[model samples]
Target chain A: MIGRLNHVAIAVPDLEAACAQYAGPLGAKVGAPQDLPEHGVTVVFIELPNTKIELLYPLGDASPIASFLEKSPAGGMHHICYEVPDILKARDQLISDGARVLGDGSAKIGAHGNPVLFLHPKDFQGCLIELEQV
Target chain B: MIGRLNHVAIAVPDLEAACAQYAGPLGAKVGAPQDLPEHGVTVVFIELPNTKIELLYPLGDASPIASFLEKSPAGGMHHICYEVPDILKARDQLISDGARVLGDGSAKIGAHGNPVLFLHPKDFQGCLIELEQV
Candidate 1:
């Protein structure tokens, strides 16, 4: 099951550099940057007109986001997050339909304290999808 | 410059099946299927609360989307379409910044005759971004 697109995650090499790069060009500079210690990254949320573009840079090279960047080899849209009223129902539905849940059955509070769970990319045609419960 | 996300395009193996898969489970079944012969797709637009999810399947196997599906393995989200008031200016700016233009400079009318242009994913780190002039 899917919901509204919560945000589009963009992976960048450097947080400040990425912010500066997007600031003037897109006329987009509404930053809600925060660090998620559990996820191990600094997330910068730039408010777009219709959707929020999240800039994610790892706290260290060994983190998951960093590893994703190294493997992908470029900065671009990383994942599409969907906001669901019920995260557990959405996760269960997807898992039952042959999709692998990246996190444990439980979801942790993500950026802005919203409960989030990541679905394995392999299950979704190699594109990572996130489910955020509002 | 990025604009609002118009619609998140999902290239599936079959449009009908994809729509069926997302209907009952997601509590989503708002279909507005339309054919864009130029792009060679039968797009089934499913209205989400916050955004629209476009399910695309090629009209014929020789079409570009068919080839894309063949190259890729499964069904999932493809390109992220951004709604911009000015597509030409956005294209030029992106081109000036060394992003290759996938389509010609002119914006062609897409589904609902909305002007649309596709940007090369190579420049955006492997994710195809579409600019829809609204």
Candidate 2:
């Protein structure tokens, strides 16, 4: 069901600071910050050889990342995404197998302009799993 | 400096239950549990097409996962591992760039029999980062 590891998402209190850290010390090629209104966060992609690292910051008061930051304060990993060949098939299989898909159990367009679904952290042993159609 | 995303580590409360969930519902190829006394955790790797998912549980009272579980209780994503071509080079570069390398600033043999070093979460936006020499 899960394909390649798409990208790992990290919630940051300040996107620019995170970008500087990666760009300077980590020496990564960091992309321009993109505001994902639909996802309620601004994101920057740090290009890596095998995969990308996504840095996320809250965009709105209702943003889930906002709440995550409220609890963590120092920022933390938000989720890890895995690519899937088919989102609908994966979603159905996960649901039928008793895993709870988040947000009305439907696929939504993600940052990559691909269909994505989030699995509940509880069902996946406290890790928010995001499956993105590639 | 990072070669590939080796694996995403999740700290689980119950190793066996987590394994069952992945093997049964997720239909993943779960590997046998291995105990690392040095790291103080028992881990099982779930192989995916593109990468692997590591499930970790406390091995002893002083295990770091035990402390993480005490705070989270429900288990959660613990760290993300990236493969580096040379562990020593990566360590020196990260330290020179002001990132705090965890432990005594030395690489230890990890589960895959590879040298590994951990970075402090505070320096990397609260996400514990691991670099394994591959």
Candidate 3:
């Protein structure tokens, strides 16, 4: 079951520049960046109490975010992270209900060092979804 | 200066069905609904700490969310809400930097009975942005 919005992930061409944009003009504090090698993304977060803004850039080949940027043609919102109590169950149910899994159901450390998985964009009407276990 | 994300709005055609899907399977509480006529939307909110999920349905034909539903042809993530300490100043700076405002920068009571304004999608590369002052 989806609990709440954990984060809103944005695809950015430049993480440092985007972080500066948020931190300087928007006055949002950028958290330390982390690289999720499995997903081939370098993610930086703007911390909020419940939800966060994750600025993502491609780290290597076969990264989903890179394809999203190419198709989107403009850097913008990519996905919504939904917090779930049981990550495996949520992933299974979502897949059974015709949701596509971008990654195999595997827990990997994400921006906040939390276990996370991504859902394919084809599942929820072209919106990529991330399932995070907290 | 910014506060926490108040709501992450999504454009949906069926409010009742969406509410049912969320409340039934998601094990989440749906708050009381409110219609902001000025923005031409009947918004329902899912409460969360520092963040919320707003299910938006058009109240009339003039709503920007309506056109987005048409162009997109698929329901997906619509916008990201950034809680600002001063909405007025945020609007000013964003506009100066080539951000097109969908509204004339007026404060209308949104789903949570708080002042809210929408930023044009053109400014954020086809991603609609909402600014709420809490």
Candidate 4:
């Protein structure tokens, strides 16, 4: 079961401009950009009082967010992550409830180095959801 | 300045289905639908530990999310609400930093009965941002 709202990930076309916007006008504390080659994306975290806003940019040639950026050239809210206590149990519950898991239904190392799995957007009201074990 | 992430708003085509998805498969606590005729939205709040996910359905002919729903029939992230201590001060700071505020730049009563203002998506990495006084 989902526990806490982990982070809302926004795919930005321009990472520097996005960081500046959040740090300057938004008046938020933004972390330095960290490249995650394994995830095929570079991420900058905007720390909030209760949660985080992750600014994502495509990294490798087969970056997962590349198509998302193509569909939304100016970038957009890519996904919302929820923290789960036991990811395998959570996945099983979701599956039993008829919700489809993305990829090979396996958890992968996410940007935060946590085990994460994505759920099909169609099953989630067109909102891409990421479940991260916390 | 933006403080906490108050909630993430998702405009869903089917309100009942959206609520079921969250309450069932997602294992979130979903509140009853509340109609906000003035704002042209009927909403169901999914209460998370740190924040909320608001599922929005069109309430009237002039619903602000009508066009968004037309574009994304399956529903999608509409906007993100960030809580601020002083909305007027936050608006002024955002304006000074070259961010465009939607409407006449005046704060209006939001869904939670707090003063809120929306920022232009073009200036915000294509993400609609709502600032609410908390």
Candidate 5:
């Protein structure tokens, strides 16, 4: 079951501009950009009172967000993550409930270094959902 | 300044199915649908530990989410709402910082009955941002 709302990821074409917008006008505490080559994206975290917001930019040619950015040139909401206690159990339960898991149907190390799994958007009200074991 | 993330709004074509998906497979507490004729949408609130998720469906002929639903028939993230101590102050600061405020640049009563203003997606990393006085 989903616990806390971990973070909402927004894929932006200009990472710096997005970071500046949140930090400047929005007056939110934003973390420095960190490039995750494995994830093929660079991420900046915006900390709110209750949850965080992630700003993502394509890092390499094989970046997972490249296509998303292409489809939405101005960038857009990518996914929303929820914290789960046991990702494996959650995955199995979701599978039994007829929800499709993305990738190889296994949890992988997410940008936050937590074990995370992505559910198919078709199964999640057209919103990409990421489940992270916290 | 933005404080808490009040909620994330997702426009769905099938409100009941979306609510069932969150309550059943996702295992989140979903509230009963409430039709806001003024807002031109019916909303179901999903309560999470940190924040809420609003599932929206077009309620009338002039529904604001009708076009969004047409584009994303399966539903999608519509906007993210952040709590602001003073909506007017936030709006002025955002405008001074070169951000475009949606509507007539004035706060209106939002679905939750709080003063709210929407920011242009072009100015906010392609994400529609709602600022609510809370």
Candidate 6:
């Protein structure tokens, strides 16, 4: 079902400071910040040897990250993304197993330009899990 | 500084129920629960192709997971562990960069029998980060 650990997303109140932390002390390559209006997030990717870390900030008031930040003023670990070979198969299998997909039960293009679906946090023990097609 | 994603930990109220969800619906290979008295938690590993997901439950009332579950009764994402070739180097670098290492700023033997150190959530945008010497 799950392939690789695609990326771990961290919601930050200050995206630039978060990027600087990774790029400076962590000695990681940080990519340019890209805003995805559909997702309502502005994200920057910190490339690592085996996986990537996504630093996300709220794009608008309607952004989900905005609510998350309200609960946690400093921001926090938002979600963990796992890659799957087949998005449709994984989605169907998950749905059959009683997992609730966040949106309209359909995959949406994510920050990486890949099909992604979010599983309800309650279904995953309060941890928001995202499955992305790789 | 980070080598690879060792695991993403989720704190669950019921360890068995969480295991059943991953093993049954997710079709993941769930490992036996291991109790870490020092850490005050019982954890099970769900192995994926690329990385592992650690299901954590409170071992006792003093467990940190106990408090986490108090706020999020349903449980939720606990922390993210990243492998580092040298834990000491990573710790020093992180500290020098104004990151606060938790629990006396020393490494402890984790579930994988590796030297692990946890960074304060506030320093990393509220994300509790664990660095393991792999």
Clashes of each: 0, 0, 0, 0, 0, 1
- What is the lDDT of every predicted structure here? 0.76, 0.90, 0.75, 0.92, 0.92, 0.89
lDDT of 5 by residue, A19-76 (tens): 8788887889999999999889999999999999999999988998999988899999
Query: Comparing candidate 1 with candidate 4, which one achieves the higher TM-score?
Result: 4
Candidate 1 runs further than 4 Å off: A1-3, A14-17, A30-32, A93-99, A122-126
Lowest-sum lDDT 10-residue window in model 4 chain A:
A18-27
Candidate 4 lDDT, tens digit per residue, A69-102?
A: 8989999899999999989999999999888999
Clashing pairs in 6: A126-B76
Native-contact recovery for every candidate?
0.48, 0.67, 0.44, 0.81, 0.88, 0.84
Once fitted onto the true fold, the runs of candidate 6 whose alpha carbons sit more than 4 angstroms away are none
Q: How accurate is candidate 2 locally (lDDT)?
A: 0.90
Candidate 2 docking class = medium
Better of 2 and 6 by DockQ: 6
Q: Please tell me the interface RMSD, in Å, for model 2.
A: 1.5
- The residue-by-residue lDDT of candidate 6 on A13-130, one tens digit each, is 9998999888887777899999999999999998877788899999976999999899999999899998988999999988888889997989999998899999998888888889
lDDT of 2 by residue, A104-129 (tens): 98899999899999999998888899
Q: In model 5 chain A, which range of ten residues has the least summed lDDT?
A: A16-25
Question: Candidate 5 lDDT, tens digit per residue, B30-76?
Answer: 99889898779999999999899999899989998998988898889
Per-residue lDDT tens digits for candidate 1, residues B1-134, read 66677888878876665676667645675586888787888898878777787888888556677887877657656787878788888878877766687856678888758888887776554667788988
The residue-level lDDT of candidate 3 at A56 comes to 84
| Model 2 C-alpha lDDT per residue in residues B8-126, reported as the tens digit of each score | 99999988999998888666789999999989999999998767889999997689999999998989999999888899999999898888999899999999999999999999899
List the TM values for chain B, per candidate. 0.91, 0.98, 0.82, 0.97, 0.96, 0.97
Q: Kindly list the per-residue Cα lDDT of model 4 for residues B1-134, writing each as its tens digit.
A: 68999999999999998888788777789999999998899999999999999999999899987888898989888999999999999898888888899988899998899999999998888899999999
Quick one: ranking by TM-score, best first?
5, 4, 6, 2, 1, 3
TM-score of each: 0.86, 0.95, 0.85, 0.98, 0.98, 0.95
